[model samples]
Target chain A: MKTASPFLELEAAPARATVWFDGEPLDLPQGANLAAALLAAGVAVFRHTPASGAPRGPFCLMGACFDCLVEIDGVVRQACMLEVEDGLRVTRPHEAEDSGAPV
Target chain B: MRQCDVIVVGAGPAGMAAAATAADAGLQVALLDEQPRAGGQIYRDVDRVAALRGGILGKDYTEGRALTAAIRRDGIEHLDGAVVWAIEDGFCVSYTRAGQAAQVSAPKVILATGALERPMPLPGWTLPGVMTAGAGQILLKQSGLLARRAVLVGTGPLLYLIAAQMVRAGTPPVALVETQTRADLMRANRHLGGALRGWPYLAKGLAMLAELMRARVPRYTGATTIAIAGDGRAEAVTFRSGGKPRTVACDTVFLHHGVVPNTQAARSVGVPHRWDAAQHCFNPVVDAWGGTAVAGVFLAGDGAGIGGAKVAETAGRIAALKVAEELGRLSADERDRRAAPLNRLRSRQTAIRPFLDAAYPPFAEALAPADATLVCRCEEVTAGEIRGYAKLGCIGPNQTKAFGRAGMGPCQGRYCGLTVTALLAEATGQTPDQTGYYRIRPPLKPVTLGELAAMDDGARDAAE
Candidate 1:
């Protein structure tokens, strides 16, 4: 069943791809814009700032602002610039650091 | 490494036209874009979006289909998903594609890098659900996603365009909180003649406004002290409209003042820039043909200045003609003959700019946000800190790096450069030009150490 979301997807995708966001699996539209797909899937916060630990999401979907920075394959990249691919593991950058996890 | 006669960085209207024009003149051209498709932000995924939701974004967007199709001709190589990080001396361009670094060099380079939404730094602007109106449009264009109960804020044609688009998508914004006032329109009255010459653009704006009104989307004009209030996400927008405080509840807040040239790539290449007082941003100093002081380097489109997409396309053609002449592909006489019409069209297209700039000038508060507002999102630097730096004898953006690491973050001051300059200028009572901008360095986009090392290895292998 499609989950209730504040964001609505206007088009139906040909397929669904399961991508993990911070270890939670989300079945997003295959090959859809990653940031949009995540938002439609009810994942609002993409990362938390290292300074004040404030939540940040994609502000400029065109890749100007770095607010949408997410850790993928151990590298931080803009989620807005990426596409939703099946089995892609994405995590919020600075989450461990902000949570006082070991460096 | 790949070699071409001309290389165009960005696949937007300017870059597309440049590549297509140069290629049509028998010059080898490679067009590089950050997106996975040819359409730059203006036409982001135009081919797909137009096919799926025809006319939802309106004719202005779908019209880009012709330009996007123009690049399909022979001799034009389109490289997508390429994040150009550097334009080194000798016109060598370095970009990363699919986690691998690549190099493409050319005798001439056209930086048609396009524009970025002028940063609107209000309180709670960094909240999770607060995004630029351009972002909202991109969501609709790229993924056909629309925010539920969103409120469009700020002043500009783009804000209205997005509101109309949302209404077309059956999800009209709850309201529009506009900051432009009658005084702004009065200030813009002097440019009415020129704006009249650009009647099509004026007509489009009026039509979009009419569409919003017909949809009954309440619009609050002459709003001030606008701020987003939320716990961790945007819950509502608060502002003073017509001398009365009002709060509009919404899940999303789309903010936009206007767009300015995305000059980071051009600046990275050491091209000189000057403050555009009318547009209130720094733009590259370029000739009519888009040639800069940097030899063999040219710029076109919004990256040169904030002329819209149509102006950018004409500028691209004019620049390509000049570049072709420089490369001996066309005679000076032929280049001039070909460029004359384009130059005229570009001027006509840009006629609406002065009026638009004066009428919907960037919100005054956003130009220099409150002391507590976060100016530098990456460094989490506050506007107060920037002012403090100015007080401590900090002259320009570079010095802020040492004082508080303002422009040293991943974005490299793309978002906060103008605000920092404005803050420093206000605090020190210096002009924005005197206050100056960040010395943009490459890699322009963030690249991993592994990618850089691998790039070096790739270069060495190519040499061997």
Candidate 2:
């Protein structure tokens, strides 16, 4: 009826990780995506609209939706589709963040 | 353990057909079915729904009522709402009844657990109104009601049948988005020659299409729904129409890639499966008589192959013949005569399989869900996490479970296993069948710690 999850205890990945995200020193499993690692790290709200200021998060997790767009390295790509790297720099643009009080 | 002569699981078309055929042969059959009613998802219990909604039986399920009605007669013990979790040597079945651990022992076992529709992961597949094609059909068949202006996304006859039903139920879809090309449909139709003998089936399906056409349901072939643009519920779907992207405003987007056999129980028992290229899913190989590689265990219906209700009915009959022969109840000549119609049906099924398989070949390219797409929706595991688990020498789902915590949650891999398997297949270049479904075991659902401690003898308290 049930079984234990293998990834439940896994914290890190193989050594010498090289890929990078927004522009931060990220500690994540090798080959994991920015969205998944971020989700694991509790960064549920990934991006926001500039005009409406509505909160946007990774919805489909698949690249089909494009709801998880973030500034990775340099280009605006779907965070749900890309793998992770050490020392990745990930940043939320002012337009991509809700500017109201810290809710 | 309380013992019985035979225990047939899944009260659907195959199980009912199997139990009835065996009973007709004078074997005391104990039929264990998970649904509150006998009909599996195909006959999905719409007697009341049909009584309410009207005209949703759609021929295939209408034919199933006769077999279920046969269960009401004596000698066939129908245990509805009884979910069988595991089977052991001597065919000890572990299941739950009234939230209590229970078991049923039988000499011979027949697994007729049927197939389920494959939910293609798109942007909004998780949305409220977005559902599998079968789910939509169940809604209409049972309630004779539906949301207005649907966009049915899928391939094969399921979409055709369901869309036509939707029109009848008052939805009247704007257009049907088919993933198979017209050329593929032509190739699918070529097998129609061999299948021409099943004229009634052909006519019935054609009639559904006619309803859709008469209602002006524009069918766009080779289209895939890539995006669903709406808040909360589905308001519109953005799909690639014939390779060119377009958007259709429809409240409901009924989706179904195709059907895949529910294989968790089989996987748990180590039942080996072959890559059924025609079904694009893993299926256990069984002899014409329904005997699997495992002794005393027989496979039947869509669980063995993704054939329709007719094939399922015949498969059930063949299992009964084999069981009767094993019990020395069937004379050789009688058995041969009884098996004739099924053999003919198999030949016809073989003829059309190639076209159906080619047309609906599991949406391979769409397997890789975006990072946000929840692989294990219950545990919030994403496709990216699954990929991470894949690189760590985890070749199978069981091993991946150790590294990702994805499938080990409530909903028990129902929402995520297919999506994960497809992702694994894409990464490893293995077919979808090779990526095994979740392994089922006793306590098919979570139980309290006290319940485990209270367990005693596994054999039934008393035989039905």
Candidate 3:
């Protein structure tokens, strides 16, 4: 299956760092917002809702909606609220595993 | 125990304007925001995004460049990445930044917290790929991205704006589904005279509509029974348009139903708010100058109500001028004279609000979804479950929360509070105002024990 990406860099900005999403390495633009970077890499399913086990993605990427919860370096954070850095590890939180606090 | 003359929460148009105005008036101002940058959501990354993608986002976005630049200028202490979790009555704000707990105190505080998309609790809204249109716009604004194929749903000027933005980005939605009825548009026409006074806004909306028409994206109006359908993730949308059922195949479904002020901070601080019948939501009560009943605490911009960027910026300036005058920094005469023009601009900006509100009132059926639909995504509580509790004689949102864990989740009822009130109001014979909103508990947002420990440690350090 091919990964689907809805994002494309409009300008030819050079890649500055790489971040790992679900163990897949993706190069990202320097200072790029993490949520945008993940979406660009075709990783849309940020995590599954704990209550219903339904897959959920980022909504209201400004952190108003908590739908973009993901675990980064063992701490849960809103991907949209964070910036991409080199060598950062991102993972989806599983059921019964609490993501970090409310955004 | 740090003190400043003024502390502004939120860095959007209102907060930025407030901070800059107060600072320029020779007051010590601390501007705090959750994002690393100062531009609030409307102007998110205005400094960088405008320079990069200004042509696509349009003039209103690019206009934010001035506000962001002013926030970056001197006289204001800008603290980015600070998540304010609590606002105490004595004008103290407790927050966490970089895993450290701290507090900032001031004689006056401005909550320019901005707005959030009104919750549209629908079947499959909890599913992946079913996101808000604003979220999609943020992707494009932040990284220049759009869904490969998305079906934009719901109504209001924002709906058309985002669709037009997508068309400009060379990735227009595969389809556009509008839930607004012809009657709604007719009712809006009654406000035409007032809207005509704000010709610029009317023109902008018309331009966006024209762009969509020129693109010839499949358009559906008076949409009903709208549901996102997929096995687990959204892959198709089913709705009835013009009394005929239709389906659009798409990977993503973008939904928007206008916006509502973010009243959590104000409500937390015991600032009284009232239900706005015309707008169909509760708004923090503020005087003409954005002064809350709680002296020294104020709400400006959309957080006060659903005024757009122009009104928010002007309102912010007015609030700051009042703050400065109250704090003895600016004389009352100077404040009123400086505010005259901004107030006039605000009147012009909001002139068309009545028309927009009548045209795109809350989709009550959509907001109050079917029984089986998930009302609280965090707690996974269904509307059926909430209604069941209401049948058992739950009178209010707080009572409903106690009966079922609907509003106890991490979001702290940001998404579900309105929906819960609406559902309960429908189930019971009570108005939404009578049912009231959640009685918010402290730690308004989730905070770690470590962060609390740091607060004590920081206090000890200050004592030393």
- The 10-residue segment with the lowest total lDDT in model 2 chain B: B455-464
lDDT by residue (tens digit), candidate 1, A1-103: 1235778888789899999888789989998889889989988889988877888888998888988989887678899899989999888985533344555
lDDT of 3 by residue, B1-464 (tens): 88899999999999999999999999999899998887888888778788788999999899888998887776798999999998886677888888888898899999999998888988888777788887887777777777878999898988899889889988889998988999999999999999999998899889999999999988898898888898767889998998789989988888998888888888988888788889878899899999988989988999999998889999999999999999998999999999999988898989999999999877766777889888888889999999999999898989987898998887889888888988898899888888899987678666788777878565558647
List clashing residue pairs in candidate 1: none
- Look at candidate 2 and tell me the lDDT of residue B370: 77
Cα misplacement distance, residue A17 of candidate 1 (Å): 0.5
What ranges in model 2 sit over 4 Å off? Answer: A1-103, B46-54, B242-244, B331-333, B368-372, B429-438, B447-464
Model number with the top DockQ: 1
Models 1 onward score TM values of 0.97, 0.75, 0.95
RMSD of each: 2.1, 14.7, 2.7
Per-residue lDDT of candidate 3, residues A1-103 (tens digit): 1166755567755867888777678887767888878777778688877766677787778876778888875667788888889998888864223444454
CA deviation > 4 Å runs, candidate 1:
A1-4, A96-102, B456-458, B462-464
Across B159-221, the per-residue lDDT of candidate 1 in tens digits comes to: 988999999989999999999999999999999999999999999999999999999999999
Which candidate has the top score in TM-score? Answer: 1
Name the candidate, 2 or 3, with the larger lDDT value.
3
How is the predicted docking of candidate 2 categorized under the CAPRI scheme?
incorrect
